[model samples]
Target: MNLESPKITLEKSATEAFNFLSDVQNFKKLMPENISKFEVLGEDKFLFALKGMPEIILKKKEVTPYSKIVLGAAGGKLDFSLIGNISEIETNQSTVQLTFEGDFNPMMSMMIKGPIGKFIETLVTNMKTAI
Candidate 1:
């Protein structure tokens, strides 16, 4: 399954936003309220549980200074990647977008697409407000 989040114009510089997102712990503020647990294991890794979903651990897979951050989960029932893209709009403003890609069986993809898409959308929307 592949899903792209809406682009958001943020009231912060690209570097500022990048700094906020570089730390995985800050992600808790962007999660759905239904998230039941969150744990920060390292600067680049964290584990989280959603109300009706199994706990998942994600770690930074790659990053480029002030421009992009990619996160992925290692061996698991769900193989997925979440990417964040940032661009400077002005000295004090930036544009941000998020995309989520998941590798799942056809049946599971069809079953989870809607909910997962909405979840990513919510996360992107919250990023705009959270910044």
Candidate 2:
């Protein structure tokens, strides 16, 4: 399954946003308000738990300066990739996008599509104010 966050314009420059996101720990600040626990395990990894979901550990997979940051589940029931794409719009302004892609069976996809979509939307919405 593939879930995408809406493209958002942010006040920070592309490089600034990239720098912030390159450090996976910063993602804890962008999670939903209902998240029960958040832990920064290391510079490249973090764990978080939502209201009804199991803990998920995210690790930085790759980062391309001022362009993209790719993250993946470190070890969990879910196998997924979260990608952040950044583009410069103007001086001190940037366009940002987030996408979540998971490997799920049909039944699981049906169960998670809506929630995942909403989660992505909430994440991006919060991210707009975060940066």
Candidate 3:
């Protein structure tokens, strides 16, 4: 399954946005207010849990400087990746969009489609201020 977030413009430059997101510690600022738990495991990994979902561990899988960042599930029942794409729009502004890709059976996808979609939307909406 693949889900993409609506593109959002940020007040910061692409480099600034990328730098902020590169650090695991700064991710908390982007999470929803309902985030039940969030913990940085290391420089490249973190663990997080939402109110009604199981804990998920994600690690930085790849980075393309100021262009993109890819995070994948460390080890869990699900195999998925969250990708952040950044593009400079002006001297001190940029646009960001997030994509979520997951390998799940049809049944599982059907079950999670709604919540996961909302989750992505929330993350994107929060980016307007969080970034």
Candidate 4:
């Protein structure tokens, strides 16, 4: 699997950052407005269907105190837990790193190619407001 790890540094409180980043429901708001839809599967899980995108279901595989939230995403046909993953958070320095992991198929790569940067920028922009 090709892993794409993206990092961001923010000026915010630990509790604020953790709460904002941990809630999957806030992702659509935190994300760029270009994103069309986000569905929270549970407290730490979500299924996102981007505009002109394939559906992806994910779960928060791990979480730690103000430090991290790791998510695993996959197609329904696959093992579900082993397909794709995203990890992010910060306990110090007000910095955060979000990493995307999984087997990179052509479609996923294409989607990533077009908008990952904007997504990150808007994510930081919007989530910062949550602080």
What is the C-alpha local distance difference test score of each model?
Answer: 0.90, 0.88, 0.91, 0.58
State which candidate has the highest lDDT. 3
The per-residue C-alpha lDDT of model 4 at residue 94 equals 70
For candidate 4, give the lDDT. Answer: 0.58
In the range 54-95, model 2's lDDT, one tens digit per residue, is 888889998889999998999978899989999999989998
In model 2, the runs with Cα more than 4 Å from the true position are: none
Candidate 2 lDDT score relative to the true structure: 0.88
For model 1, what is the C-alpha lDDT against the true structure? 0.90
Which portions of model 3 miss their true places by more than 4 Å? none
Q: Tens-digit lDDT track for model 3 on 12-110?
A: 999998998899888788887789999999999999998988999989999999989999999988999999999999989999899999989999999
Lowest-lDDT window of 10 residues in candidate 4?
78-87
Please provide, for model 4 over 64-83, each residue's C-alpha lDDT reduced to its tens digit, 9 standing for 90 to 100.
76666666764474332321
- Clashing residue pairs, candidate 1? none
**TM values, all candidates:** 0.95, 0.95, 0.96, 0.67
lDDT of 3: 0.91
Q: What TM-score number comes out for model 3?
A: 0.96
Worst-scoring 10-residue span by lDDT in model 3 = 122-131
- 87-123, model 1: which lDDT tens digit per residue? 9999999999888988899999999888888888888
